[model samples]
Target: MKLVKVYVTLKESVLDAQGEAIKSAIQTMGYNQISDVHMGKYFELKFENDYANLEKDVDLICDDLLANPNVETYRYEILEGE
Candidate 1:
């Protein structure tokens, strides 16, 4: 089997409001050293070992469904799975 670990994040040009809020809250709690934060999404997909079009399919899935092409970008790693 194969485990696909996908990470999706906003493009650099886009503002991460949620992350900024989290950082503000953390700073209010007295952690003044906080510089910046960015929020993102992670996904795990399991595929059979025999799947021949894994990479192509993964890219299509990410581009078509997992992420917004205009504001977000994604990268994934394939790992051996039990």
Candidate 2:
């Protein structure tokens, strides 16, 4: 089996209001050391077979489901097990 880990986040130029709100709350709670918080999404996918075509399938998933190519950026890693 192959395990895929996907991470999706807004582009640097895009505004992240949710992340800002969380940072503000943290600061109010006396956490002043943190700065520039960014929000992101994580997804884990398991493939039942065809390890040889893993990269192609993962690219398709990223393009079609996991990420919005217009504004969001994403990266994925594959873990193999015996």
Candidate 3:
């Protein structure tokens, strides 16, 4: 078995309105040190397959389902399971 971890976040050039709103709210409560915040998504996949082909499969998954390549960037890691 293998465990796959995926992270998806907005591209650096993209504006994160939701994050900005949260940051504003936090600052309103007196957390002034928060300069910026970016929101992201994480996924954990459990698969009973060979790790050799995992990267390609994960990339496909990210491109097709997990992320929007136009506005988001994604990265993934695979770990051997016990």
| Pairs in steric clash, model 1 | none
Model 1 agreement with the true structure over 1-82: per-residue lDDT tens digits: 9999999999999999999999999999999999999999999999999999999999999999999999999999999999
Candidate 3 global TM-score = 0.90
Candidates' TM-scores?
0.97, 0.90, 0.90
Which sequence of candidate numbers ranks them by lDDT, best first?
A: 1, 3, 2
lDDT of 3 by residue, 34-78 (tens): 999999999999888655777788899999999999999998888
Per-candidate Cα lDDT values, in order, are: 0.98, 0.89, 0.92
Query: Model 2, which residues run further than 4 Å from truth?
Result: none
Winner of 1 and 3 under lDDT: 1
lDDT of 2: 0.89
Instruction: Please list the residue runs of candidate 1 whose C-alpha ends up more than 4 Å from where it truly belongs after superposition.
Output: none
Q: Kindly report which residue pairs in candidate 2 clash with one another.
A: none
